[model samples]
Target chain A: MKIIVLVKYVPDIEAGYQFNSARRLDRGGDGLLNQLDEYPLEQARRLAEQFGAEVVALTLGPDEAEEAVRRALQMGADSGVHVCDAAVEGSDALATALILAAAIRRLGGADLILCGAGSADATTSLIPVQLAARLQIPALTGAASLTVQDGAVEIRRDLDAWSLQLAAPLPALVSVNDKTGEPAYPSAKAVMLARKKPVESLDLADIGVDPAAVGAGGAKVEVASITPAPARAGGQILDSESDDVVAAFVALLQANALI
Target chain B: MSDILTLLDDPAREAERLAFAGAIGRPVGVRLAGGPELAARPGTVAAALATLAVERDAAAVLLPQGLFGAEVAALLALRLGAAAITDVVAIDPDLTATKPIMAGTAFSRARVTGGLAIFTVQPGLEAPPLAEPAEVVELAPPAAAAGEDRVAVLGLTPRAASGGRPDLLSAEIIVSAGRGTGGDLGPVEQLADALGAAVGASRAAVDAGWVDPSLQVGQTGKTVSPRLYVAAGISGAIQHQAGMRGAGLIVAVNEDPEAPIFEIADLGIVGDLGEVLPAAAAAVRAL
Candidate 1:
């Protein structure tokens, strides 16, 4: 079996980011792979190890995003592919999917493609389904646990009220949530070995990607602005002597029917 | 502007309203369902459809992605000769464009190949759009009498454990405590009280039994994007940060200056949370 794990490089959420004069994130320094993406990477690695399958980590971003692919390799991916090009920048969800679909096709396709339910930065959570649609495959999302056997993939999905177990044929897309398991940390030995592994860099031209299908022109929604959210007003703490504070708190709760 | 109409089931009205308003303009009609005679009478869905057909003359219909709404939207789209787009987050300008992909990690631009594209937006991804006063024209109850759908209301029993402030998803301010709270929830509550913030706990603190599991925030728990988030004694973990990283302002109070929480915090205080929180609360009150 062959599996492809889609990964993304995101700004470290814990990093205090300041927008440069261009109103974009300052990315000259290092940023880590999106924390959510790790779950899928680990799940892919474990599945590959269990089935003796080949696992490939694929990422689409700027050239600097190679760090994310390297990290995936260090974590046990058999090889890595970087779909790097300036044309990929500022691409909205649609453009990104088109590029990824093109790359997946170029890679000779796979028996399965796994992705995190959502990325930390955008949290759009729309990639996997769109990719499945483009590839004409069944896509299951919000999967808490997944297993492969007898040429079919069984998955348990977390719904609002109950868990649903469904099975799909091979050559399907599955978006795994972090509930699957905690992502494993790479060992020192794996990190050292990752350097020797091959990471193929593919440009938009190499993948036969049309420039118009990516970047700003392909984006549907325009970000009017990115401003700070409104500030929250502090509340008064009720003291033993202050009936007003106590009354206000109780009234607020009652009004919302939370009492 | 192209108008978008959203249908509502009164029982899920709040969520439906938020979902609709978050996606398009003010919803045109509000339909009530699950009455005592509903089983014997015409379904409210028919009435809602009629209202959309006659009054709103809705160009398109939208619903959230789920079992009931998905079925309804698909049926309505087919009936109206509208193109169907499922699991969409945002509609582009001209109303003819749609961008729906996987939970939103990637997007694909698609135009309504046919007229009146019906789409469903995923909940929790897009914020509800602002409300505007629209002249609501209520229709008389459907005369067909209720028993069309056999789905019965066996008994409506609300869940307990509902007293924990606003959900982290909708809360504007969150006061999250970590291991440094010393298993004493008093000070954390006091701080939450001062700021009118919802109480949240890190997975580590929750695992330590310092807080309830329901209050845990992280990749494994709830994702929150509050306007202001205050972390006390929590050394930011990548998993935890994934949940609250979208917060507008982050303030960290930790005894260790090297704590990872400080790295993301806009304001950092290297001191005991027990001391710092009380002082900060008092200062906020004074202001």
Candidate 2:
């Protein structure tokens, strides 16, 4: 059995960020594997161990994004693939999914494709479904728990009001959320050995993607404008440390008619 | 300004979409109500919508912003070669959309350069200026949707209602807790109950198994905008702020004075949640 987990390199949200003149994220900053992507990587590693599956980690980004694939290898992936090209920059979710679909096909597909519920930077949660659509496969996304057996993949999803149990045949896509489980930390030995894993790099042409169909040229949507979110002026902080504090808080709620 | 179509899984959520479509100022030629059967099958729904959009000359397709709505919109847009954006908070007459990005730390105004535009309207918009009632159309699954046949639903169980608490999305008041709760939500629940508010949790609390993942609020979790949002024990990371910063009023209680949550809070109280939350509940009950 073979499993491919899609991972991404995102700017550390805590480290902060800035937008370029084109209103794109400045990727020349400190970056790491998106926290959410770890969940699927961990799940893929577990499945490889259980079923003797070949686990491959895949990512799409600029030259530096190979770091994300290397990180995945350290976490137990057998190998890594990086789809890196200048033309892939500034591509929206639609184009990104299209390129990923092409890359997956180029790799000869898999028994199961796994990924995070969403990328931390985009947080649109669009790629998994879009990729599934492009691939013409069933997508069981936002899975809290997932298991593969009997040539099918099943997952448990906890929605706002329902807990759904969904299943799809092999060669399907599954996007797992943080609830799946905590990712295991790579050992120091694994980190050193990860450098030995073969990392294949592909550009848009290699993936059969037209340069004009992606990046700024193929972007279906354009950022009209961007601005810092208007800051909220914080109110007074009551530090009385007494009963009066509770009274004050309640009174303020009443004054605002929030209760 | 051109033809628009809307697909809502729940009729109960129609008002918000109506208001959103009204904001776009276009004729909604059709409103597809995604009942149980259709809502359960997004691939089928997307295939049907793909045909419907072309047939109706729909320039835009709107749906409720949530997990289901996002799925259908993405699939439909891909099939139609259209542009899709999710969790949109506002739309201008010219089709420019305003949405939070980078975990609500910033806002992006974007527009589809060409072709149809698909959007999922977030909840909590005002009622439509004039209700434009359109015929509710039910579509039969298209043959192309047969591709979805590979998937099956094994079971679905509705979560037991939480003590009649309002849903976190639609609740007017929400009391959320975080790491400081020490995995004990009793105080948070009490405060929420006293105020008739919904219960919420930050990622820390959810990660620590103090609360259900469904109740989590953050960039990766559910976004909420209640009239009153109370954060207790949460230090307020940027991800957490992205989910709740839109609330009309924010009251934060944390032991740390330098917690990032206090920076955006409308009301900041420096104290322990265990003592402050219970006391606040008692005070609210007396009211």
Candidate 3:
């Protein structure tokens, strides 16, 4: 069996993000792979190891995005493909999906495709479904757990109050959530070996992509501006001098119906 | 714009549509998602879509998180020859979006395909851009069958209690207790009451059962992007930051000057939460 995992490079959340003078995210010098993408990467690696299948990690970004592919290789992926082009930056979720769909098709497709339910930065959980739409495949989002056997996939999804088990045929797309557990850390040996693994780099033209179809120029929505959220004015506090602060606070709470 | 129509349930829907119009640089249309009762009705899905199609000629639609279903978004995107981008945190001038990847480790820029686009914006990322009222056309609800196989809202229960406080995820202002609270949430709750804020617990505090799991804020727990997030008695952890980093204003109260929370905080109170919260609460009330 063959599997493909999609990975993305994102801003490191811990570092905090700021707009540059140009009003774009500063990128904080270096961007890390979207944290959620790890789940799909790990899931793909496990499936490959279990079924003795080939797993490929694919990413779309600038040349710098190879770091993400390298990290995936270090995590035990068989190989990787990097779709890098200057135009790829500033692509919206749809354009990105098209680029990925094109690349996956060019690679002769796969038996299964996996993605993180959503990335941390944008939190747009739409890719897996959108990609599946583009590829004309069945897609499931927010799978908490999954098992594959006999060319079928069974999944457990959490729907706020209840757990649902769903079954789908192969060649499907599944977006995994954190219910799968943390992705294993790469071993030092794997990191060392990753350097020796094969990673193929491809450009937009090489994938038969129209540069106009996948970048800022192609996006249908635009952001007019962004400003700091309006400050939340602190609510009134009662007398502070004594244990009655609690009582006063409670009184205020009652007045506001918060208690 | 003749090509775009907005779908909403009420007058406030105008705010959301205007916000999108301001962002998208296009004329906007408004379609009521229906009345309060009709909006949440299980059979409203098809009606909502049909209204979108008829009144607005809405090729595609954008919804905020929690208001729409992923399945519906996908179906609508396909139906309109559009792409769906859920959880959009930020959009660039050219309409490219920067969304979180991994859990919150990085961000990627993406664009939607086809002529139409559907997106669900992440809450609190930006204020809805307000515009002058656009024409709002009310259409009859579509047939009920359009909602079949769509998500069903079983019930609307109040968020779980977190030591008598609202769910941290839904809290507008959170007063979080960490190890610095010394296992006592009394002071934190006292301060929270004073400020009309919800009480939240760090993973450490929750694991210790000093607070409920519903109050836990971190990678393993609820992610909150409140307008104001106040962290007290807790040292910042990368995991904890993941849940609250999107908060608009982060206020940290800690005795230790080197606590990591200070790095991301807009205001740092260099004292114990026990001592500082009471004082801050008093100050706020006096004003």
Report the C-alpha lDDT of model 1 over A46-101, residue by residue, as the tens digit.
89889998999999887678888999999889999999887776665556777898
lDDT for B164 (candidate 2):
75
For all predicted structures, in order, the TM-scores are 0.63, 0.94, 0.67
Better of 1 and 3 by lDDT: 3
Worst 10 residues of 1 chain B by lDDT: B145-154
For residues B1-287, write the lDDT of model 3, one tens digit per residue.
44444455335345655566456544455454343323222224434564455564554455545323444565565445566666567655445665544345445556654465565555444445555555555556554333232323333334333445554555778999998888977777877877778888787887676876556777656667886788888898877876787776777777787787877776666665777677667655664
> What is model 2's native contact fraction?
0.78
Candidate 1: stretches off by over 4 Å: A16-29, A228-259, B7-26, B29-199, B205-215, B218-287
- Rank the candidate models, highest TM-score first: 2, 3, 1
| Clash number for each model | 28, 0, 41
Question: Residue-wise lDDT of candidate 2 within B123-142, one digit each (tens)?
Answer: 77675554556545666545
- Go through the candidates in order and give each one's C-alpha lDDT: 0.64, 0.84, 0.65
Q: Point out where model 3 deviates above 4 Å.
A: A11-29, A159-162, A223-259, B1-51, B59-62, B66-75, B82-164, B167-172, B177-196, B201-228, B233-250, B264-287
On lDDT, who's better, 1 or 2? 2
Docking class of 3: incorrect
What value does the lDDT take at residue B7 in candidate 1? 52
Docking class of 2: medium
lDDT per residue for candidate 3 within A85-159, as digits (tens), equals 888766766688889999999899998898886665555555666687677766655666778899876676554
Candidate whose TM-score is highest: 2
Q: Cα deviation in Å at residue B194, candidate 2?
A: 2.8
